[model samples]
Every structure is written in structure tokens, then in C-alpha cells.
Target chain A: MAEKKIKIIVAKPGLDGHDRGAKLLSRIFAEAGMEVVYTGLRQTPEMIVEAALQEDADVVGLSSLSGVHNYFFPKVVELLKAKKLANVLVVGGGIIPLEDIPELKKAGIAEIFGPGTSTEVIVDFIRSNVKAK
Target chain B: MFDVKELEKIKAGKKKWSEGTLAKTLSKAPEKKAKTTWSGIPVETLYTPAENAGLDYESKLGYPGEYPYTRGVQPNMFRGRFWTMRQYAGFGSAKETNARYRYLLGQGQTGLSVAFHLPTQAGYDSDHPLSMGEVGKVGAAIDHIGDMRILFDQIPLDKVTTSMTVNAAATALLGMYLSVAEEQGAKYDQLGGTIQNDVLKEIICRGQYIYPPKPTMRLTVDLIEFCQKYVPRWNSISISGYHIRESGSTAAQEMAFTIADGIAYAEACAARGIPVDSFAPRLSFFFNAFTDVLEEVAKFRAARRVWAKIMKDRFKAKDPRSMMLRYHVQTGGVTLTAQQPLNNIVRVALQTFATALGGHQSLHTNSYDEALCLPTQGAVTVALRTQQIIAEESGACVTVDPLAGSYYIEYLTDKIEAEIEDYIKKIDAMGGTLTAIEQGYIQKEIQNSAYLFQKSIDSGERAYVGVNKYTMEEPPVTDLLRVDMKVGEEKAKELKEWRAKRDNAAWKKSLDKLREVSKTDTNVMPTVIEAVKAGATVGEVCDVWRDVFGQYRPKEFIS
Candidate 1:
């Protein structure tokens, strides 16, 4: 039998229009042989959670360049927990300041990738951390 | 372990090599002879006078401010007046950004560049549920005329040239700008500025596009026609390659793709019974100044030459103004690194110099701390100072087209021009930018380049300073601009009650007109302006357009 592939949902929360980093990450995930579904730019937290649940994703890779993570990611985590999908890995990236990394991690962001992060690191992190239900 | 059979076969084949021949001499030439530069141009072992054989002055490279404008746009560029020193600033409420704009203007900035927040760029009001957390996060939040009024409250509309980096809601923003100017009692003819209203690039590079390509093209044509008739001094659209480059495109791709989009806009205007010469002269471009100094300079030279040729030959543009390619340059934002952030200062300084050498009409240098968070006041000042130091001290602007007549640059320029022409022909084969975008061809090309770049960095072929090579321990960032959390709440509250206060009847009337014109072949600018004057918010105007021209659902790309 074939080994199960990790399912990743790469989404842009809130209204951040910049998507170079998110799109790049999607390609990286796809090339790593993972099933990657890219929720296009400007997706809200509820829409992201809905997509995550429907896609049955094992990892949610959220990228925000708009600096709205303080309001966006926390809501996403709360909704995911309410929906009983807390085990799913939630990775974040973009122009995130180092200071907020701990707060985001506490709020259930499994890993944070800032600018200049290598695609290999993200792919490897997903492969290693995204657990099969 | 050694491949003795292959060695024996090679030795046998080289029978002419006598016993006197050394083992090294018996080996074949190196597999990788030439090096592939960042821009993908292959550098040969040596270049001589023969390389300059076909290229000639007055033909291939005319004088600055002349046809096939390879040298530069103005006859006395910078010598007459230096390029516009514009800084891209916008964040939090319109009032906040307005204060920043006033500060920048006071600091001797020659031009104004507005960077709208994501909600405004996406044609949504700050009160929209989708815009909840994002208001004022990336750039300034502008919901209606009230916000716009605050944006330019103290600034003189007639004196300064403003460039608003907006696309999806460009018509709405432009309408608001006109309304704001009118409210300030300034004549429409006296206003000058640029709207980065290029929608095609939105589909190709950035994903901030609202409507589908057809409606977006219509909007682009509408702006061009309106500018020609009323705001004759304003550039209708800034066909941007900056986002394309920031999205990981090569230098040649940036030039070719942006010019192709420009051609598409010109053609769209022609389809609307607007003459090419009438609207083409008002078209401007926005480009990114990347790390490769010589390559960036060559890219600009080739870009001007290629655009002039396209205007004259493809579109048959008659007026000289129509043939000139004027553009503003911003240093590549992606080049700034968060690690050893101060290094970005040097990167931006070099890139800014490249912009100067490339004959940019205006320039914005990225701040050192931008890779981390929004630039603080001191950081923005340093960013502005970088440009000032270059203009006042570097002496780069003492002459026009300073890099002109250099043998290598000319050769590289010729090569890049040829390569880009080949790309344009390919795009033409795909039925221009619209069809290419619809087919996801441009998106795929950019993604492929991005992937390859990532792979290069992964395999250690490409090195980024302070990232892949130089080791460093970063000091904690002491000064970073943290946005007030209340800004979003304030934006939401302001937009909510402002809607309650507007004249509903007039808003409905103008919106109805906009809806009717949006469905018809009429230029939508006048209708949009009427709507804005009637206090129909940007979100409402966009809703009408959205109702007429349905929202675009991006086609899926399977890697």
C-alpha cells in the first residue's frame, strides 16, 4: 500500500493582497508530493477554517504580509479547536516580527516562517510534524 | 570505484594524443565554460570590438529624449531636474497616513506615493467582514470621501504629483481623488499624479485583482479615455513590472511582460475609438530596481527601446509623447533580508543608484527594517535619506544615461531586447496578455521561475548575503512601528456611521447610473466620478461593478 501524503491548505487570512510568499509556498508544498490546496488571497478566518475542514487537511499553512495576524490567526486557531481539529499543524509565514512568534506559537501556531525562509524548511517541517489521523 | 572502462574508451578514441600528452591535456574541455548571471545572461570568455559590430549610435541607441529611446527619456534628465524622490507610505487610518505624507513632503520629497491597504485595493470598505482584521495593516485604510478628505486634508492637490498604488478599486480611488480635489476647489486640469491602475499585472503577478479580465480591461480603457479628456496631466495607469519582479520573475520577463501588458492597454483604448497617440502618452510604468546593478541598468535601457519600438511599430503611435517610456522605480522589496537587517540599507542604496543610472522618472527606496515590520519614523527617514545621499552626493545624476556607451552594457542590452522580443512574439501567439492570463500561462511562467530560484537557493547555487553565506548574530530590534490595534476598530466605526449619514437617495441614483454604464460600452470614469460626488462609497461602487461583472474565480493551477 502507498504511504499517505500530507494534506496542506495554504491560505491567506483577512485582506492581505500580497501573495508572492503564499503562492511560492504552495508550489513548494505541491512539489514535495503533498496535496496542497491554495485558498486564494483575502480569505477570512471562517472561510479558511471551512476550507481546512472540507479539504481534511493535515496542515494549515497561513501566510500574512499585512500584519493582521494578531487578529486573524487567533480566531483561526479558536475556530479550529471548536471544530475539534486541534491536532492539525498550523504554520505561519511572512513579514512577522520575531517578538510575536512566541505569542503565535502559544495560540497554536505550530511553526512560524519569516521572510527569507527556505521552501525546503517549510516542506520538511510539514512532513515531519503533520500527523495522520 | 574508478570508471576504468570509460577512461580506456576515451584513451582509445584519443589515439592521436601521443604518450607525450599529459593526462590533464587528454581531458575534454570543461562542461561549464560560461557562467549564468542572475539575469540569466551568459557571459562569454572575452568581449571585443567585434561584439559592438551591429550596434550603432543614432540608430540602435539614439540621443536621450529621442526615438527608440535607449539612452534615456529626457534630453537633460537630472541635469535639468533630478528624478522625483517619492517614498511609498501608507498605514493605519487615512488621518495617520496623511500625517506621514505631510511629514514626507516637509522632508523635501518631490512627489507623493500612496500605498493603499488591502481592503481598499480589493474594492472593499473597512467595515466589510472580510476586512475585519486587516484594516490599516499593510497600508492606509480609505473607505469613503471622508477618509479621502482626511488623506489629503492639509496637502495642496495642485502642487504635488501623487501616485496611488491601487488597481481593483483604481476607478473608485481616482473618483475619490477627483472629488477631493473638487471639494478643495482645485480645477481637474490642475491635478497631476499616477494611478497604478494596471489590472493585468494583478492577474499575472499580484492577486489583488477584483473583476475578471474583460471588465478590468474595460476599466483600464475607461481611465485612459477619461485622462485624455479631463485630467490630461495625469497618467491613467502605471503598467507595473515591479510586482512581477517581486514575484520572482527574471529581469527580461519583467520588461517583456510589463510592456506586453502596456500594449494590451493601448489596444483596449484603440478598441474604444480612442486614438493610440492620445492615450498612449499618458501611460506610465513602475519597475523594480534589483540587486544586479549592470543587469538592472540594461533591463531599463532595453525596456525603453522595446517600448518605443512597440509604440511606433506595433501600435503605429504618431506622437512623440506616445513613444516615450516614463517610469518610476522602487528598489526590490524581496531583496531586503530580515537577518542582519542593516545590510538592506546598503542593498537599497546600490539599487537606488541603479535606478538613477537606469533613468527612472521617480524612485522609492525600501527601508532597512521593512523586512521585519512596518518602517518606523526613523527607518523611513533613513530610507528617504538614502535617496537624498545618492542624489546630492553620489554625483550619479550629473550626466544623463551615465551607463550609456559602455560596451558590455550595450551588448547585454541588445541581448535582453532580443530575448524579450521573442517573449512578446510568444505572448502575441497566445493572443496577447488577456488570453495568456486567462490560460494561466503568465502565472505558470512566474511560478516556474520562482520555483527554480528556490531550488537554486536550496542547492547552494545562489547565495543571499546574511542568509546563505555570511553568518551573523542579529541584535534585537529596538525600534519598529507597531500599529495601534484601535485603528481597525476606529476604521470600522467610522465607516459604519458614515454610511448611515450619507444621502441614500443620491447614492442610489449615482450607483444606478454606474450600474447601467458598467453594463454598456460607455466609459465608466464619469459615472464613477458622479457616484463618488454623490457620496457612493468605494465599496458600493465596486458592488455595482461586481453585480454587473461578476467576481473572478481564479483558475486552478496544478503545479
Candidate 2:
């Protein structure tokens, strides 16, 4: 039986222009036989959510490096919920402090990967946490 | 190099030593790691003069302070004076950043580098919807001359050298800065500072570009022209490879792409009928001093040699200063690890050694807490003190080109230079950097290198200390600095008040004049200065330019 490939939308939100992580992840996801939609730099929360819904992504990784992660990450989650994207798994990374992880996960982020996280862990997390429904 | 007889003797001795000594050691314990560096350049067990046999020392590496400067740019180098310690800083409001600048200056920081918030860098007002959550996060928020004045208030502009980390809106920022200097009663000719006005790299890696390549190149060239005439002491454009490296380019790619961009800028200015010698002297470069100590040292030396040849032989520049490649180095930001946070301090210290040994004219060391948040005052102080300790305690300042005449260093220097030249040749054949970028050649190359680098790290081919090996459990870092969200609202309120109180008639007249200059071959600085002095906001002035020169949409590349 053929299974559906995992589709992920990697978007860099807010005004921070550091896209090394997002671009690398997008490439790695594609190389891992998944569909990756990359929203270029300076994407607003609304734009990110729109892209996620339009791409029919099972996982949306929001990368925010600026210290505004607390404001931007939650807004993305809220917008995702408002759009009835409850089935999509949301992940956050890039300069988010360890203390903020619990609150972010509570706010509907499925996983929060801090720096030095191996790509294998992220890949496995996506494979398991992303709902196949 | 050794004489023929001595070379023969040394070669015979080396062959015997490798067979007996190296074979015995390898038999006991084979090499575990791959024989390559992080950049994928192969490494030899040992380098010797045999590897540097064909190197033309006199032509490739002339005297220190001579053309084709490979050893050092200046005659005495660090023996005469230490490199300027420029700390890159900015966060919160203008008033807050102003205080930080003064504090750094008081602690013996020699230069000021301003990091603008995202909105400012992207040419948006603090109140713009696109800037809602990002007004003053990464850097300070400056809306107009009012904030610019506050940012430099009480600090003597002429006595202190400043560097603004701006690109898209650099024209307005430079205008605001010059107005500040005028208000300080200092002549424009005596101002010492740098504005990172190079937009080509923004289009390539950084996403702060405001206009298409043609108009953006015009703006970059206009600054070069205007600074050559008025702001004689200022570096108009800092040709940047730092961001390219931060985007995961190899050291050779960093050198070649940066030099290629400089070539494009020079060619643009030439097409505008400006003499090369008129502006080339003020042209400075910004580079990344990564953790590869020997590679970095060789890269710096190779850059000077390459740029000198480009100016003298290619551009036919007559001035000696035009051929001299002066540069500022910043330690790599991406190399810092969030795990085992204290391990970063050692990484930074070692990287700082690379910058000092690479003969950087100025340097900025990354703070330890940057991998977590904006560096706090204590972290920034430690960052600055790292440079200071290297200058005072370390034996770095005692000699010039201290690592000269090393077998490995010379060999690597030659190798990196050849590879960089190869890339430059490829770029040149494709009709220079702008054409190459538009065709997605450079970006794809960089993206491929980045992917290879990431794969190597993931596959354990390249080992990061606390990341893949030496694992440990540590708690979250709590002492990191956080910018209060009130900075954005406060700045918006201040901008509203400033606009409401300003003379609307004069502001419009100045902006109208700015709009007029945007459509012609006339210089943009005078009108930009007039508009900024007339209370035009940063966004307002940039909006005028945006109306005339269309905004740039980046080209996408997949590798």
C-alpha cells in the first residue's frame, strides 16, 4: 500500500531575515521524500497560515529568530486555530528559550526544537506527531 | 624556500620520517576523523615546502604595505596599533541604544556599529503593520531625524567613528547621520563612519533589499559618488562577505563572491563616469572570521592579494591606497551553540584569535548569549573584554604577520587563493555578479554548499563539540536579555507626536525635492539630507524612493 508523503510548510515569520535554518530544513524535508513549501523571509502570521492551509501541510514549522518569538509564535498558532487548521502540527524553533517551551507547547505547538537539535530528531518527531488522518 | 640541494636533502629526510614515524603511529591507531575540514577542503597529514614549490613569493606576497599585500596591509601591522574594537549593538529605542553606545565607548570601544531593527532595515516605519511585532527587536528603532538625533545625542560625532548596519534605507540613515554631524558643528568632510549600503548581498542572502538590481546599484553608486565628494572620511559601501558566510558559504566562496560584488560596484560606478581612484580608496570590506584559524588567516591574506591585483592590474587604479584592502572582521554568529552554553565562550575566544591573526583592521566578537537572545550588558562586556585581553595579554600585538613563513600556512594560502580565483573567473565569464545572481547561479552554489555543510554535521562527518559528542544535560539559560515590547508602542507614539508637531509644508517641500532627484542623474544625498533635516521620517523618505525605484522581489533557487 502506498502512503501519502508528509507535506510541511517552513515559513520564517516576523522581520528577522535569518533563513539558513528554514532553507536547510526545507531542503532536507524535500530530500527526505516529503513535499516542502517554503515561504520566503518576512512572512506575517496571516500569510504563514494561508500558505499552510493552501499547501495542505501536515506540519508547519515556524522559525523566528528575533526576540519577538513570544509574540509571533503564539499569533501563528492562534491564526492556525482560527483557520480551523486543528489537524496541522505546528513546530517552532530558532532562539526560543528553554523556559518558553512549555508555554509554546501549551499554546498548540506540537514540538519546540532549540539549537543543537539533530535533524534526525526533528524528522522522527514529524513522522510520529503528524496525524495521518 | 630552501635551495635545490637543501630541498633534496629535506625531501629525502621527510620521505624516511613519514615511512618510519607516520607508519608506526598509524598502525597503532588509525585516523578516526575524515581528512577534510568543515569547508570540505582536504587536509594533509602534514604540509611542507614541497607543497609550496611553485609559489612566486615576490609576486604573490610582496612586502607588508606594498602592492599585492599578502602578509599585512600596513608596514608594522599590530606592532604599531591594535585593530579597532567595533562592537555591533542596537536594541530598543534610540535613547536606549544611545546609552549603550556611550557605555561601550567608555569601556574603550574604538568604533560604533549600529544594528537597525527589521522595520528600519526593510524601509518601513515603526507604525507599519508589517513591523507590528518587529519594531525594535533585533536593533534600535529610528523613524526619522528625530530618533537619529536622539541616537547620537551627547556623543561627539567627529570624535567617534560610527558604522551603521543598514542596507535598503542606508541613504536615509546616512542623511540622518550627516545632519547629526552638522548639528554637532562638525564639518561633513571630517566625519568618520561606515554605512553598510551594499544591497547586492541583500538580494542574494539577506532579504532587506528595497529595489531591483538596476536602481539599487544606482543608489549604492550614488553613495560612493557623494561620499567621495563630501564625506571624505566615511566608508560609503562596506562590500560584505560576512552575511554570505552566515548564509553558509565556504571560505573560498565568501572571498570570491565578495570580490565579485565589489567588482560589480566598481563597474557600476565606472559606467556612471566616476574615476576608480576617486572612490576605491574609501571602499572597505566586511568578512567573517570563522573557527578555522589557519583557513581564516590564509583567507584574509589571499583577499588582500586578490583585491590589490583587481584594482591595480584590472581597474588601472593609480593611487596606492586604492589597492590597499582594509577590512573589518566579525566572528561567526551561526557557529555558536545553544547547548552547553559556556562552551561558546571558548569557541569565541578561539575565533577571536583567528581574527587578530588574520590581520583585521577592525573586529567584533560575537557575545556568548547570542545563540539564546540579544546579549546582555554583561555578555557584551565579556565579548569586548575578550578582544581587549587578546590585545593586552596575548603575544598577538608584539609582532607583525607573526605566522608568516609557516609551511602549512603558506601552502593553504596558495591553495585558497587559487580556488577563489577559479570562482571569480567563473563569475566573470557569466557577465559579472549581478547577471550571475539574476540567473540564480550564485545563490544555488551557496545553497548547495550550505546543504553539504548541514549533511556533514548531521552524518557526524564534521564533529561539533557539545552537539554530537560530549553530550550533557543542562538547564535553560535564564540570564539572557529580553527587549521589552513597549519599545515599539513608545516609538510609534513618539513618531506620531513628532510628525504632528513638525511643519508639514516644509516636510512636503523637502520630500518633493527628494522625489524630483530620484528621477534624474543628479546626486541624491543633498536632497536626502535636506529632506531628513526638514523632519521627513525614515519611511517617508524611503517611500519616495520606493515610488520611483520599484521594490525588488527576490529570485528563488532550489538545490
Interface RMSD of each: 1.6, 1.1
Q: What is the DockQ of candidate 2?
A: 0.77
What TM-score would chain B receive for each of the candidates shown?
0.93, 0.98
Please give the lDDT score at residue B240 for candidate 2. 96
Candidate 2 per-residue lDDT, tens place, B53-163, comes to 766778877688988888788988888889999999999999899999999999999999998998999999999988988878899998898888899989999898999
**Model 1 local distance difference test score:** 0.86
lDDT by residue (B286-348, candidate 1, tens digit) is 999988898999999999999999999989999988999999999999889999998999999
Across residues A20-42, which tens digit of lDDT does each residue of candidate 2 receive?
88888889889888899988888
Off-target runs (Cα >4 Å) in candidate 2 are none
C-alpha lDDT of residue B376 in model 2: 90
What is the Å distance of residue B341 in model 1 from its true position? Answer: 0.5
| TM-score, prediction 1 | 0.94
Instruction: State in Å the error of residue B90, model 1.
Output: 0.8
> DockQ of candidate 1?
0.67
